[model samples]
Target: MHTESQLARLHTADLLAQADAHRIAAAAKPPVELRTRVGWTLVELGLRLASAPGPVPATA
Candidate 1:
């Protein structure tokens, strides 16, 4: 009986933890428009960095 109670309590705690984690994740996620803009900005920055010229080698 005590073991069963302990198990139930543990199960409840786990469910509560999962709910909290889901709520936090939902809250932390950016809106679609903001995510899109940030994604595009990162892509543009990556392209610019990729296309940037390297330093010229010094002639001996």
Candidate 2:
């Protein structure tokens, strides 16, 4: 099983990579501001998830 941080890191890396690709694609349109926002958002979420190093309490 993946530890939370490990899983989060994997997920964040994937998103950051996608964002970079999107940024590159935006080059086709000089004025277009296109970096996949979801990628950055996911990265933030992943970071938050990874910060806690221990079992999570179950929500009732």
TM values, all candidates: 0.48, 0.45
Worst 10 residues of 2 by lDDT: 29-38
Over 1-60, each residue of candidate 2 has an lDDT whose tens digit, in order, gives: 999999999999999999999988887765623466677888999999889698879999
Clashes of 2: 0
Clashing pairs in 2: none
lDDT of model 1 at position 54: 85
lDDT by residue for model 1 over 1-60, one digit each (tens)? 569889999999999999999999999987679788999999999999999998989999
lDDT of 1 at 39: 97
State the displacement of the C-alpha of residue 29, model 2, in Å, after optimal TM-score superposition.
3.1
Candidate 2 TM-score over all chains jointly: 0.45
How many residue pairs clash in each candidate at the backbone level?
0, 0
Question: How accurate locally, in lDDT, is each candidate?
Answer: 0.94, 0.86
Give candidate 1 regions above 4 Å deviation.
Answer: 33-60
RMSD of each: 5.3, 19.2
